[model samples]
Target: MIEENRFPVIETDRLNLRQVTKDDAESILAYLSDQDVMKHYGLEPFDSIDDALDEIAWYQAIFEKKTGIRWGITLKEQGRIIGSCGFLNIVSEHRRSEIGFELSKEYWGNGMASEALESVITYGFEQLNLQRVQALIEPPNISSQRLVERKGFIREGLLRNYEFTCGKFDDLLMYSLLKQDYEKMSYST
Candidate 1:
Protein backbone atom coordinates (compact mmCIF):
# COMPACT_ATOMS: atom_id res chain seq x y z
CA MET A 1 0.00 0.00 0.00
CA ILE A 2 0.87 3.73 -0.12
CA GLU A 3 2.44 5.35 2.90
CA GLU A 4 2.00 8.98 1.93
CA ASN A 5 -1.55 9.52 0.68
CA ARG A 6 -0.84 12.32 -1.75
CA PHE A 7 1.98 12.15 -4.28
CA PRO A 8 3.50 8.92 -3.05
CA VAL A 9 6.77 7.85 -4.61
CA ILE A 10 6.15 4.86 -6.84
CA GLU A 11 8.90 2.49 -7.87
CA THR A 12 9.10 0.12 -10.80
CA ASP A 13 11.87 -1.84 -12.43
CA ARG A 14 13.08 0.99 -14.69
CA LEU A 15 11.44 4.10 -13.29
CA ASN A 16 10.43 5.93 -10.17
CA LEU A 17 7.30 8.07 -10.27
CA ARG A 18 8.24 10.46 -7.51
CA GLN A 19 6.89 13.76 -6.28
CA VAL A 20 7.70 16.73 -8.48
CA THR A 21 10.10 19.31 -7.05
CA LYS A 22 11.52 22.62 -8.17
CA ASP A 23 14.82 20.83 -8.69
CA ASP A 24 13.27 18.93 -11.58
CA ALA A 25 12.54 22.08 -13.56
CA GLU A 26 15.59 21.77 -15.77
CA SER A 27 14.89 18.14 -16.55
CA ILE A 28 11.23 18.84 -17.27
CA LEU A 29 12.10 21.79 -19.47
CA ALA A 30 13.96 19.47 -21.83
CA TYR A 31 10.72 17.86 -22.98
CA LEU A 32 8.23 20.65 -22.29
CA SER A 33 10.25 22.91 -24.52
CA ASP A 34 10.35 20.44 -27.39
CA GLN A 35 7.76 21.15 -30.05
CA ASP A 36 7.48 17.50 -30.90
CA VAL A 37 6.83 16.65 -27.28
CA MET A 38 4.19 19.34 -26.90
CA LYS A 39 2.67 18.89 -30.36
CA HIS A 40 -0.58 17.45 -29.03
CA TYR A 41 -0.10 18.54 -25.42
CA GLY A 42 -3.00 21.02 -25.45
CA LEU A 43 -0.63 23.88 -24.64
CA GLU A 44 2.30 25.75 -26.07
CA PRO A 45 5.79 24.42 -25.48
CA PHE A 46 7.79 26.02 -22.71
CA ASP A 47 10.11 28.71 -24.08
CA SER A 48 12.30 28.87 -20.99
CA ILE A 49 13.23 26.95 -17.91
CA ASP A 50 11.24 29.50 -15.92
CA ASP A 51 8.15 28.05 -17.50
CA ALA A 52 9.06 24.68 -16.07
CA LEU A 53 9.68 26.31 -12.69
CA ASP A 54 6.21 27.78 -12.85
CA GLU A 55 4.84 24.34 -13.64
CA ILE A 56 6.61 22.96 -10.62
CA ALA A 57 4.81 25.56 -8.54
CA TRP A 58 1.55 24.54 -10.19
CA TYR A 59 2.18 20.89 -9.42
CA GLN A 60 2.90 21.66 -5.79
CA ALA A 61 -0.12 23.93 -5.49
CA ILE A 62 -2.46 21.32 -6.87
CA PHE A 63 -1.17 18.69 -4.48
CA GLU A 64 -1.42 21.09 -1.57
CA LYS A 65 -5.02 21.80 -2.51
CA LYS A 66 -5.83 18.13 -2.93
CA THR A 67 -7.09 18.77 -6.42
CA GLY A 68 -4.36 16.94 -8.39
CA ILE A 69 -0.88 15.50 -8.22
CA ARG A 70 1.84 15.24 -10.85
CA TRP A 71 4.76 12.92 -10.44
CA GLY A 72 8.17 13.41 -11.95
CA ILE A 73 9.25 10.25 -13.77
CA THR A 74 12.81 9.40 -12.81
CA LEU A 75 14.89 6.95 -14.82
CA LYS A 76 16.69 5.29 -11.92
CA GLU A 77 19.66 3.92 -13.79
CA GLN A 78 20.25 7.14 -15.68
CA GLY A 79 19.56 9.17 -12.52
CA ARG A 80 17.59 11.84 -14.28
CA ILE A 81 14.01 12.95 -14.54
CA ILE A 82 12.67 11.86 -17.91
CA GLY A 83 8.98 12.82 -17.76
CA SER A 84 5.83 13.31 -15.73
CA CYS A 85 2.46 11.60 -15.20
CA GLY A 86 -0.47 11.92 -12.84
CA PHE A 87 -4.06 12.99 -12.31
CA LEU A 88 -4.76 16.12 -14.27
CA ASN A 89 -8.02 16.68 -12.44
CA ILE A 90 -9.57 15.11 -9.41
CA VAL A 91 -13.31 15.21 -8.88
CA SER A 92 -13.46 13.91 -5.35
CA GLU A 93 -17.20 13.57 -4.97
CA HIS A 94 -17.39 11.71 -8.25
CA ARG A 95 -14.59 9.39 -7.22
CA ARG A 96 -12.80 9.88 -10.49
CA SER A 97 -9.89 11.75 -12.01
CA GLU A 98 -8.51 12.83 -15.36
CA ILE A 99 -5.10 11.38 -16.10
CA GLY A 100 -2.29 12.87 -18.20
CA PHE A 101 1.34 12.10 -19.02
CA GLU A 102 4.34 13.13 -21.12
CA LEU A 103 7.71 11.49 -21.70
CA SER A 104 10.96 12.78 -23.12
CA LYS A 105 11.48 12.09 -26.82
CA GLU A 106 14.50 9.93 -26.15
CA TYR A 107 12.38 7.63 -23.98
CA TRP A 108 9.42 7.29 -26.31
CA GLY A 109 8.47 3.83 -27.67
CA ASN A 110 10.47 2.17 -24.90
CA GLY A 111 7.51 1.22 -22.62
CA MET A 112 8.75 3.54 -19.85
CA ALA A 113 5.56 5.53 -19.97
CA SER A 114 3.54 2.40 -19.41
CA GLU A 115 5.66 1.44 -16.44
CA ALA A 116 5.20 4.84 -14.79
CA LEU A 117 1.51 4.93 -15.63
CA GLU A 118 0.88 1.49 -14.20
CA SER A 119 2.39 2.58 -10.90
CA VAL A 120 0.38 5.81 -10.65
CA ILE A 121 -2.85 4.17 -11.84
CA THR A 122 -2.50 1.46 -9.27
CA TYR A 123 -1.94 4.09 -6.58
CA GLY A 124 -5.03 5.98 -7.69
CA PHE A 125 -7.31 2.96 -7.50
CA GLU A 126 -5.91 1.18 -4.47
CA GLN A 127 -4.80 4.07 -2.29
CA LEU A 128 -6.95 6.96 -3.43
CA ASN A 129 -10.08 4.84 -3.67
CA LEU A 130 -10.88 6.25 -7.05
CA GLN A 131 -13.65 4.47 -8.92
CA ARG A 132 -12.87 5.76 -12.40
CA VAL A 133 -10.06 7.35 -14.38
CA GLN A 134 -10.40 9.22 -17.65
CA ALA A 135 -7.93 10.33 -20.30
CA LEU A 136 -8.27 12.89 -23.05
CA ILE A 137 -5.96 12.51 -26.01
CA GLU A 138 -5.68 14.59 -29.14
CA PRO A 139 -6.90 12.66 -32.16
CA PRO A 140 -3.51 12.59 -33.82
CA ASN A 141 -1.62 10.97 -30.96
CA ILE A 142 -1.97 7.32 -31.86
CA SER A 143 0.74 6.18 -29.46
CA SER A 144 -0.94 7.77 -26.43
CA GLN A 145 -4.28 6.31 -27.43
CA ARG A 146 -2.75 2.88 -27.65
CA LEU A 147 -1.06 3.28 -24.27
CA VAL A 148 -4.32 3.93 -22.43
CA GLU A 149 -6.23 1.25 -24.30
CA ARG A 150 -3.62 -1.34 -23.47
CA LYS A 151 -4.14 -0.50 -19.80
CA GLY A 152 -7.89 -1.36 -20.08
CA PHE A 153 -9.40 2.06 -20.79
CA ILE A 154 -12.33 1.87 -23.18
CA ARG A 155 -12.88 4.50 -25.82
CA GLU A 156 -15.90 6.47 -24.71
CA GLY A 157 -16.43 8.93 -27.56
CA LEU A 158 -15.01 11.82 -29.49
CA LEU A 159 -15.23 15.41 -28.36
CA ARG A 160 -15.18 17.32 -31.58
CA ASN A 161 -13.10 20.53 -31.49
CA TYR A 162 -12.87 20.14 -27.77
CA GLU A 163 -9.84 22.34 -27.23
CA PHE A 164 -7.90 25.17 -28.77
CA THR A 165 -4.21 24.44 -28.68
CA CYS A 166 -1.12 25.07 -30.78
CA GLY A 167 -3.00 27.90 -32.50
CA LYS A 168 -5.93 25.76 -33.69
CA PHE A 169 -8.94 23.87 -32.49
CA ASP A 170 -8.36 20.17 -32.01
CA ASP A 171 -10.56 17.14 -31.47
CA LEU A 172 -10.03 14.80 -28.56
CA LEU A 173 -10.82 11.15 -27.98
CA MET A 174 -12.12 10.26 -24.56
CA TYR A 175 -11.26 7.04 -22.78
CA SER A 176 -12.06 5.78 -19.32
CA LEU A 177 -11.37 2.87 -16.97
CA LEU A 178 -13.50 1.77 -14.07
CA LYS A 179 -12.06 0.44 -10.85
CA GLN A 180 -14.04 -2.72 -11.28
CA ASP A 181 -12.45 -3.15 -14.67
CA TYR A 182 -8.97 -2.82 -13.21
CA GLU A 183 -9.86 -5.15 -10.40
CA LYS A 184 -11.01 -7.76 -12.87
CA MET A 185 -7.79 -7.39 -14.79
CA SER A 186 -5.71 -7.91 -11.67
CA TYR A 187 -7.70 -10.90 -10.45
CA SER A 188 -7.47 -12.59 -13.83
CA THR A 189 -3.72 -12.64 -13.53
Candidate 2:
Protein backbone atom coordinates (compact mmCIF):
# COMPACT_ATOMS: atom_id res chain seq x y z
CA MET A 1 0.00 0.00 0.00
CA ILE A 2 1.15 3.56 -0.70
CA GLU A 3 2.09 5.52 2.37
CA GLU A 4 0.07 8.62 3.21
CA ASN A 5 1.98 9.76 6.28
CA ARG A 6 4.56 11.79 4.40
CA PHE A 7 4.60 13.35 0.98
CA PRO A 8 7.57 12.31 -1.11
CA VAL A 9 9.79 14.91 -2.72
CA ILE A 10 11.57 14.08 -5.94
CA GLU A 11 14.52 15.97 -7.30
CA THR A 12 16.27 16.00 -10.65
CA ASP A 13 19.19 17.97 -12.05
CA ARG A 14 17.06 21.00 -12.95
CA LEU A 15 13.79 20.58 -11.05
CA ASN A 16 12.33 19.78 -7.68
CA LEU A 17 9.03 17.95 -7.33
CA ARG A 18 7.53 18.85 -4.00
CA GLN A 19 4.14 19.21 -2.37
CA VAL A 20 1.88 22.04 -3.51
CA THR A 21 1.12 24.67 -0.89
CA LYS A 22 -1.48 27.38 -0.48
CA ASP A 23 1.22 29.97 -1.16
CA ASP A 24 1.49 28.55 -4.66
CA ALA A 25 -2.03 29.61 -5.55
CA GLU A 26 -0.89 32.61 -7.52
CA SER A 27 1.65 30.63 -9.52
CA ILE A 28 -0.83 27.85 -10.13
CA LEU A 29 -3.33 30.41 -11.32
CA ALA A 30 -0.78 31.90 -13.64
CA TYR A 31 -0.58 28.88 -15.92
CA LEU A 32 -3.91 27.25 -15.17
CA SER A 33 -5.57 30.48 -16.23
CA ASP A 34 -3.82 30.44 -19.55
CA GLN A 35 -6.10 28.99 -22.20
CA ASP A 36 -3.28 27.43 -24.19
CA VAL A 37 -1.84 25.59 -21.19
CA MET A 38 -5.23 24.39 -20.04
CA LYS A 39 -6.48 23.59 -23.52
CA HIS A 40 -6.36 19.84 -23.05
CA TYR A 41 -6.55 19.99 -19.26
CA GLY A 42 -10.31 19.34 -19.45
CA LEU A 43 -11.33 22.56 -17.76
CA GLU A 44 -11.86 26.19 -18.55
CA PRO A 45 -9.18 28.67 -17.60
CA PHE A 46 -9.33 29.67 -13.97
CA ASP A 47 -10.34 33.31 -13.61
CA SER A 48 -9.91 33.62 -9.84
CA ILE A 49 -7.38 32.66 -7.19
CA ASP A 50 -10.14 30.72 -5.47
CA ASP A 51 -10.12 28.28 -8.35
CA ALA A 52 -6.42 27.64 -7.76
CA LEU A 53 -7.06 27.24 -4.06
CA ASP A 54 -9.71 24.67 -4.86
CA GLU A 55 -7.19 22.84 -6.97
CA ILE A 56 -4.70 22.79 -4.11
CA ALA A 57 -7.39 21.50 -1.82
CA TRP A 58 -8.14 18.71 -4.24
CA TYR A 59 -4.47 17.79 -4.21
CA GLN A 60 -4.58 17.64 -0.45
CA ALA A 61 -7.77 15.59 -0.44
CA ILE A 62 -6.32 13.03 -2.82
CA PHE A 63 -3.15 12.66 -0.80
CA GLU A 64 -5.02 12.28 2.46
CA LYS A 65 -7.26 9.70 0.86
CA LYS A 66 -4.23 7.86 -0.55
CA THR A 67 -5.76 8.13 -3.98
CA GLY A 68 -3.17 10.46 -5.55
CA ILE A 69 -0.07 12.63 -5.19
CA ARG A 70 0.74 15.83 -7.12
CA TRP A 71 4.10 17.50 -6.96
CA GLY A 72 4.73 21.09 -7.80
CA ILE A 73 7.53 21.50 -10.31
CA THR A 74 9.96 24.24 -9.34
CA LEU A 75 13.43 25.28 -10.26
CA LYS A 76 16.09 24.60 -7.64
CA GLU A 77 17.20 28.23 -7.72
CA GLN A 78 13.68 29.71 -7.82
CA GLY A 79 11.33 27.65 -5.75
CA ARG A 80 8.06 28.88 -7.17
CA ILE A 81 5.88 26.37 -8.92
CA ILE A 82 6.10 26.45 -12.71
CA GLY A 83 3.80 23.47 -13.14
CA SER A 84 2.70 20.18 -11.59
CA CYS A 85 2.73 16.39 -12.20
CA GLY A 86 1.56 13.28 -10.40
CA PHE A 87 -0.34 10.03 -10.27
CA LEU A 88 -4.09 9.85 -9.63
CA ASN A 89 -6.80 7.26 -8.91
CA ILE A 90 -4.32 4.80 -7.41
CA VAL A 91 -5.67 1.32 -6.89
CA SER A 92 -3.24 -0.51 -4.64
CA GLU A 93 -4.86 -3.89 -5.04
CA HIS A 94 -4.56 -3.53 -8.75
CA ARG A 95 -1.20 -1.77 -8.57
CA ARG A 96 -2.19 0.86 -11.05
CA SER A 97 -2.58 4.63 -11.28
CA GLU A 98 -3.25 7.42 -13.77
CA ILE A 99 -0.53 9.93 -14.60
CA GLY A 100 -1.06 13.61 -15.44
CA PHE A 101 0.96 16.79 -15.83
CA GLU A 102 1.05 20.31 -17.27
CA LEU A 103 3.57 23.11 -17.55
CA SER A 104 3.58 26.87 -17.93
CA LYS A 105 3.64 28.05 -21.54
CA GLU A 106 6.93 29.81 -20.96
CA TYR A 107 8.51 26.49 -19.99
CA TRP A 108 6.82 24.28 -22.59
CA GLY A 109 9.61 23.21 -24.97
CA ASN A 110 12.40 23.12 -22.42
CA GLY A 111 12.01 19.47 -21.31
CA MET A 112 10.86 20.45 -17.82
CA ALA A 113 7.72 18.35 -18.05
CA SER A 114 9.72 15.34 -19.15
CA GLU A 115 12.14 15.72 -16.26
CA ALA A 116 9.39 15.95 -13.67
CA LEU A 117 7.39 13.15 -15.27
CA GLU A 118 10.35 10.77 -15.26
CA SER A 119 10.88 11.31 -11.54
CA VAL A 120 7.18 10.85 -10.78
CA ILE A 121 7.06 7.65 -12.80
CA THR A 122 10.12 6.22 -11.07
CA TYR A 123 8.55 6.87 -7.69
CA GLY A 124 5.30 5.29 -8.78
CA PHE A 125 7.09 2.13 -9.83
CA GLU A 126 9.92 1.95 -7.32
CA GLN A 127 8.32 3.35 -4.18
CA LEU A 128 4.68 2.57 -4.70
CA ASN A 129 5.45 -0.69 -6.49
CA LEU A 130 2.87 0.14 -9.08
CA GLN A 131 2.57 -2.46 -11.79
CA ARG A 132 0.84 -0.26 -14.30
CA VAL A 133 1.01 3.47 -14.88
CA GLN A 134 -1.44 4.89 -17.40
CA ALA A 135 -2.20 8.19 -19.03
CA LEU A 136 -5.44 9.44 -20.55
CA ILE A 137 -4.69 12.07 -23.12
CA GLU A 138 -6.93 14.07 -25.38
CA PRO A 139 -6.29 13.13 -28.99
CA PRO A 140 -5.46 16.68 -29.94
CA ASN A 141 -2.70 16.89 -27.34
CA ILE A 142 0.05 15.79 -29.67
CA SER A 143 2.83 17.11 -27.51
CA SER A 144 1.68 15.18 -24.47
CA GLN A 145 1.16 12.09 -26.58
CA ARG A 146 4.70 12.33 -27.86
CA LEU A 147 6.12 12.83 -24.38
CA VAL A 148 4.46 9.70 -23.03
CA GLU A 149 5.45 7.74 -26.09
CA ARG A 150 9.06 8.68 -25.49
CA LYS A 151 8.64 7.36 -21.95
CA GLY A 152 7.47 3.99 -23.29
CA PHE A 153 3.71 4.18 -22.74
CA ILE A 154 1.97 2.20 -25.43
CA ARG A 155 -1.29 3.44 -26.89
CA GLU A 156 -3.93 0.95 -25.85
CA GLY A 157 -6.93 2.30 -27.73
CA LEU A 158 -8.99 5.38 -28.31
CA LEU A 159 -11.82 5.90 -25.91
CA ARG A 160 -14.41 7.59 -28.10
CA ASN A 161 -15.94 10.53 -26.25
CA TYR A 162 -14.33 9.25 -23.07
CA GLU A 163 -14.61 12.50 -21.18
CA PHE A 164 -16.85 15.53 -21.12
CA THR A 165 -15.05 18.74 -20.44
CA CYS A 166 -15.23 22.43 -21.35
CA GLY A 167 -18.81 21.89 -22.64
CA LYS A 168 -18.63 18.85 -24.91
CA PHE A 169 -17.50 15.24 -24.88
CA ASP A 170 -13.99 14.66 -26.16
CA ASP A 171 -12.05 11.68 -27.41
CA LEU A 172 -9.22 10.40 -25.19
CA LEU A 173 -6.43 8.02 -26.08
CA MET A 174 -5.54 5.54 -23.37
CA TYR A 175 -1.86 4.78 -22.94
CA SER A 176 -0.14 2.51 -20.45
CA LEU A 177 3.33 1.46 -19.28
CA LEU A 178 3.47 -1.85 -17.53
CA LYS A 179 6.04 -2.91 -14.95
CA GLN A 180 7.53 -5.49 -17.26
CA ASP A 181 7.83 -2.86 -19.95
CA TYR A 182 9.52 -0.48 -17.54
CA GLU A 183 11.92 -3.23 -16.50
CA LYS A 184 12.85 -3.83 -20.11
CA MET A 185 13.39 -0.11 -20.62
CA SER A 186 15.62 0.08 -17.56
CA TYR A 187 17.66 -2.81 -18.90
CA SER A 188 18.05 -1.24 -22.33
CA THR A 189 19.38 1.98 -20.89
Candidate 3:
Protein backbone atom coordinates (compact mmCIF):
# COMPACT_ATOMS: atom_id res chain seq x y z
CA MET A 1 0.00 0.00 0.00
CA ILE A 2 1.13 3.57 -0.66
CA GLU A 3 2.35 5.52 2.31
CA GLU A 4 -0.12 8.28 2.99
CA ASN A 5 1.56 10.14 5.84
CA ARG A 6 5.24 9.97 5.08
CA PHE A 7 7.39 10.20 1.99
CA PRO A 8 9.49 7.12 1.40
CA VAL A 9 13.17 7.47 0.73
CA ILE A 10 14.72 4.95 -1.64
CA GLU A 11 18.44 4.39 -1.77
CA THR A 12 20.46 2.79 -4.52
CA ASP A 13 24.15 2.00 -4.76
CA ARG A 14 25.14 5.43 -6.01
CA LEU A 15 22.03 7.52 -5.61
CA ASN A 16 19.45 8.63 -3.09
CA LEU A 17 15.87 9.25 -4.12
CA ARG A 18 14.22 11.42 -1.50
CA GLN A 19 11.48 13.95 -1.02
CA VAL A 20 12.00 17.27 -2.78
CA THR A 21 12.08 20.10 -0.32
CA LYS A 22 11.75 23.88 -0.67
CA ASP A 23 15.51 24.19 -0.25
CA ASP A 24 15.90 22.27 -3.49
CA ALA A 25 14.25 25.06 -5.44
CA GLU A 26 17.54 26.55 -6.63
CA SER A 27 18.92 23.22 -7.80
CA ILE A 28 15.65 22.38 -9.45
CA LEU A 29 15.60 25.72 -11.20
CA ALA A 30 19.14 25.24 -12.43
CA TYR A 31 18.19 22.26 -14.57
CA LEU A 32 14.61 23.18 -15.30
CA SER A 33 15.86 26.44 -16.75
CA ASP A 34 18.22 24.75 -19.12
CA GLN A 35 16.85 24.86 -22.62
CA ASP A 36 18.44 21.62 -23.70
CA VAL A 37 17.26 19.72 -20.66
CA MET A 38 13.75 21.13 -20.97
CA LYS A 39 13.57 20.42 -24.69
CA HIS A 40 11.57 17.25 -24.35
CA TYR A 41 10.17 18.06 -20.91
CA GLY A 42 6.96 19.49 -22.52
CA LEU A 43 7.06 22.69 -20.50
CA GLU A 44 9.15 25.64 -21.51
CA PRO A 45 12.39 26.32 -19.67
CA PHE A 46 11.71 27.77 -16.24
CA ASP A 47 12.64 31.41 -15.84
CA SER A 48 12.89 31.90 -12.10
CA ILE A 49 13.16 30.24 -8.73
CA ASP A 50 9.41 30.68 -8.39
CA ASP A 51 8.97 28.09 -11.10
CA ALA A 52 10.98 25.63 -9.08
CA LEU A 53 9.01 26.48 -5.93
CA ASP A 54 5.84 25.86 -7.87
CA GLU A 55 7.17 22.49 -8.94
CA ILE A 56 7.98 21.59 -5.38
CA ALA A 57 4.48 22.63 -4.40
CA TRP A 58 3.08 20.38 -7.11
CA TYR A 59 5.09 17.51 -5.72
CA GLN A 60 3.67 18.10 -2.25
CA ALA A 61 0.15 18.50 -3.59
CA ILE A 62 0.30 15.24 -5.49
CA PHE A 63 1.50 13.37 -2.46
CA GLU A 64 -1.22 14.88 -0.27
CA LYS A 65 -3.83 14.08 -2.87
CA LYS A 66 -2.52 10.51 -3.00
CA THR A 67 -2.24 10.80 -6.74
CA GLY A 68 1.57 10.61 -7.13
CA ILE A 69 5.05 10.86 -5.68
CA ARG A 70 8.26 12.36 -7.08
CA TRP A 71 11.74 11.88 -5.67
CA GLY A 72 14.70 14.18 -5.98
CA ILE A 73 17.67 12.20 -7.24
CA THR A 74 20.88 12.96 -5.37
CA LEU A 75 24.29 11.42 -5.49
CA LYS A 76 25.31 9.35 -2.49
CA GLU A 77 28.54 11.34 -2.27
CA GLN A 78 26.92 14.75 -2.75
CA GLY A 79 23.48 15.31 -1.29
CA ARG A 80 22.32 17.94 -3.75
CA ILE A 81 19.67 16.89 -6.25
CA ILE A 82 20.71 16.28 -9.82
CA GLY A 83 17.42 15.00 -11.14
CA SER A 84 13.95 13.77 -10.27
CA CYS A 85 11.79 10.73 -11.04
CA GLY A 86 8.57 9.06 -9.98
CA PHE A 87 5.00 7.96 -10.68
CA LEU A 88 2.14 10.36 -11.37
CA ASN A 89 -1.58 10.24 -12.14
CA ILE A 90 -1.94 7.25 -9.88
CA VAL A 91 -5.31 5.49 -9.75
CA SER A 92 -5.30 3.01 -6.87
CA GLU A 93 -8.53 1.40 -8.02
CA HIS A 94 -6.98 0.59 -11.37
CA ARG A 95 -3.56 -0.22 -9.93
CA ARG A 96 -1.88 1.98 -12.50
CA SER A 97 0.22 5.14 -12.82
CA GLU A 98 2.46 6.97 -15.25
CA ILE A 99 6.22 7.04 -14.71
CA GLY A 100 8.28 10.07 -15.55
CA PHE A 101 11.87 11.24 -14.96
CA GLU A 102 14.48 13.78 -15.96
CA LEU A 103 18.19 14.17 -15.26
CA SER A 104 20.60 17.06 -15.51
CA LYS A 105 22.37 17.15 -18.85
CA GLU A 106 25.71 16.86 -17.10
CA TYR A 107 24.64 13.50 -15.68
CA TRP A 108 23.35 12.15 -18.96
CA GLY A 109 24.74 8.84 -20.33
CA ASN A 110 25.98 7.82 -16.87
CA GLY A 111 23.43 5.00 -16.29
CA MET A 112 21.97 6.90 -13.31
CA ALA A 113 18.60 7.19 -14.98
CA SER A 114 18.51 3.45 -15.59
CA GLU A 115 19.51 2.76 -12.02
CA ALA A 116 16.91 5.13 -10.64
CA LEU A 117 14.25 3.77 -12.97
CA GLU A 118 14.83 0.22 -11.84
CA SER A 119 14.37 1.18 -8.21
CA VAL A 120 11.25 3.24 -8.91
CA ILE A 121 9.68 0.48 -10.99
CA THR A 122 10.35 -2.08 -8.31
CA TYR A 123 8.78 0.15 -5.70
CA GLY A 124 5.75 0.75 -7.89
CA PHE A 125 5.03 -2.91 -8.51
CA GLU A 126 6.06 -4.29 -5.16
CA GLN A 127 5.42 -1.58 -2.60
CA LEU A 128 2.61 0.31 -4.23
CA ASN A 129 1.01 -2.87 -5.54
CA LEU A 130 0.57 -1.31 -8.92
CA GLN A 131 -0.26 -3.51 -11.84
CA ARG A 132 0.86 -1.15 -14.57
CA VAL A 133 3.35 1.71 -14.96
CA GLN A 134 3.28 3.65 -18.20
CA ALA A 135 5.58 6.17 -19.85
CA LEU A 136 4.87 8.72 -22.54
CA ILE A 137 7.84 9.67 -24.67
CA GLU A 138 8.18 12.08 -27.51
CA PRO A 139 9.27 10.42 -30.76
CA PRO A 140 12.41 12.55 -30.94
CA ASN A 141 13.50 11.70 -27.42
CA ILE A 142 15.47 8.65 -28.46
CA SER A 143 17.34 8.27 -25.18
CA SER A 144 14.15 8.20 -23.12
CA GLN A 145 12.61 5.77 -25.59
CA ARG A 146 15.55 3.43 -25.23
CA LEU A 147 15.63 3.80 -21.46
CA VAL A 148 12.05 2.61 -21.04
CA GLU A 149 12.40 -0.14 -23.63
CA ARG A 150 15.47 -1.50 -21.84
CA LYS A 151 13.38 -1.68 -18.67
CA GLY A 152 10.87 -3.95 -20.51
CA PHE A 153 8.19 -1.35 -21.20
CA ILE A 154 6.31 -2.44 -24.32
CA ARG A 155 5.34 0.11 -26.94
CA GLU A 156 1.58 0.50 -26.91
CA GLY A 157 1.10 3.08 -29.72
CA LEU A 158 1.24 6.69 -30.75
CA LEU A 159 -0.88 9.31 -29.02
CA ARG A 160 -1.23 11.62 -31.97
CA ASN A 161 -1.50 15.29 -31.07
CA TYR A 162 -2.20 14.25 -27.56
CA GLU A 163 -0.58 17.24 -25.90
CA PHE A 164 -0.51 20.83 -26.98
CA THR A 165 2.51 22.26 -25.25
CA CYS A 166 4.83 25.22 -25.83
CA GLY A 167 2.40 26.43 -28.47
CA LYS A 168 2.29 23.28 -30.57
CA PHE A 169 0.65 19.89 -30.60
CA ASP A 170 3.06 17.08 -29.98
CA ASP A 171 2.84 13.35 -30.59
CA LEU A 172 3.73 10.99 -27.80
CA LEU A 173 4.52 7.29 -27.87
CA MET A 174 2.79 5.31 -25.16
CA TYR A 175 4.65 2.46 -23.48
CA SER A 176 3.73 0.35 -20.49
CA LEU A 177 5.24 -2.27 -18.20
CA LEU A 178 2.84 -4.71 -16.63
CA LYS A 179 3.38 -6.23 -13.22
CA GLN A 180 3.52 -9.70 -14.74
CA ASP A 181 6.17 -8.55 -17.17
CA TYR A 182 8.18 -7.01 -14.35
CA GLU A 183 8.05 -10.23 -12.38
CA LYS A 184 9.16 -12.24 -15.38
CA MET A 185 12.06 -9.90 -16.00
CA SER A 186 12.98 -10.00 -12.33
CA TYR A 187 13.13 -13.78 -12.29
CA SER A 188 15.13 -13.93 -15.49
CA THR A 189 17.76 -11.54 -14.21
Highest-lDDT candidate: 3
Over 4 Å off in model 2, which ranges? Answer: 186-189
Question: For model 2, what is the C-alpha lDDT against the true structure?
Answer: 0.93
lDDT of 1 by residue, 130-173 (tens): 99999999878999999999999999999999988777889999
Model 3 clash count equals 0
Candidates' lDDT values, in order? 0.86, 0.93, 0.94
Worst 10 residues of 1 by lDDT: 1-10
Give one digit per residue, the lDDT tens place, for model 2 in 14-89: 9999999999999999999999999999999999999999999999999999999999999999999999999899
Per-model TM-score on C-alpha atoms: 0.93, 0.97, 0.97
Q: What are the clash counts of all predictions, listed in order?
A: 0, 0, 0
Name the lDDT of candidate 3: 0.94
RMSD each, Å: 2.3, 1.4, 1.3
Candidate 2, RMSD to the unseen true structure: 1.4
